[model samples]
Target: MLIIEGAGRWTTPTDGANDWVEHLRMPDLSVGTYCIPAGGLDDQSPHTEDEIYVVTAGQARIVTPDGATEVGPGSVIFVPAGEEHRFDEVTEDLALLVIFGPAYGSRAPAHPAPLRPRS
Candidate 1:
């Protein structure tokens, strides 16, 4: 199993997925950790893959063409493929579990296999 430590302390030079450290890369999905520094610029570009952001720590206002919404720990945010989105008003470092489907440079899983049951 892959694991990352220090969600609150992880530092990045930029905002958004650029801060993300790839933990797993599969043809069906990918997972990583991203940290956006507080008071940093929000210049996130659109993505080609659909994604979900599972907030691990800190607070931020996610801005999109639609509007802005305040989010904190445990917040689940979704951004569709090719949609403009970014994080603004970051009160604290924003750490997230980013999941991207169909992996990078690969097609989606043709048939999803059943996950192994937890012991």
Candidate 2:
């Protein structure tokens, strides 16, 4: 059995430092906490694996190639593999639970499939 304590896993971003703190890692998936202070920048690039983000606190707007969406606590969002996305305009201290399928950085560096336009 695997157990993760959320209280111990939570972390805040320091100046010029990464905001993600991974907690669990398995062959099928990986979990982590991502926190960004108000007005902080999310300088992450597209991932090779599909990702889901569950907003646990604060407010922000996620921008993608397709469009943008406002998010707040309890909001859940999904980003397909190789799609460009990032969070911006954080009005408050944003915290989220991030889940990656097939484990983060576990895939080969080969070219990923292009993202289809959402209907």
Top model by TM-score, which number? 2
RMSD of each: 11.1, 9.2
The local distance difference test score of model 1 is 0.76
lDDT of 1 by residue, 1-119 (tens): 64545432456654243375777788788877778788766676777788888888889998888999999988999988878998888888878788888664354336678799899
Runs with alpha carbons beyond 4 Å of true place in candidate 2: 7-10, 16-18, 110-119
Instruction: Estimate every model's Cα lDDT from 0 to 1.
Output: 0.76, 0.86
Q: Lowest lDDT 10-mer window, candidate 2?
A: 7-16
| TM-scores of all predicted structures | 0.74, 0.84
Tens digit of per-residue lDDT, candidate 2, span 31-95: 98988888888899899899999998889999999999999988999999999999999988888
In model 1, how large is the Cα lDDT of residue 53? 88
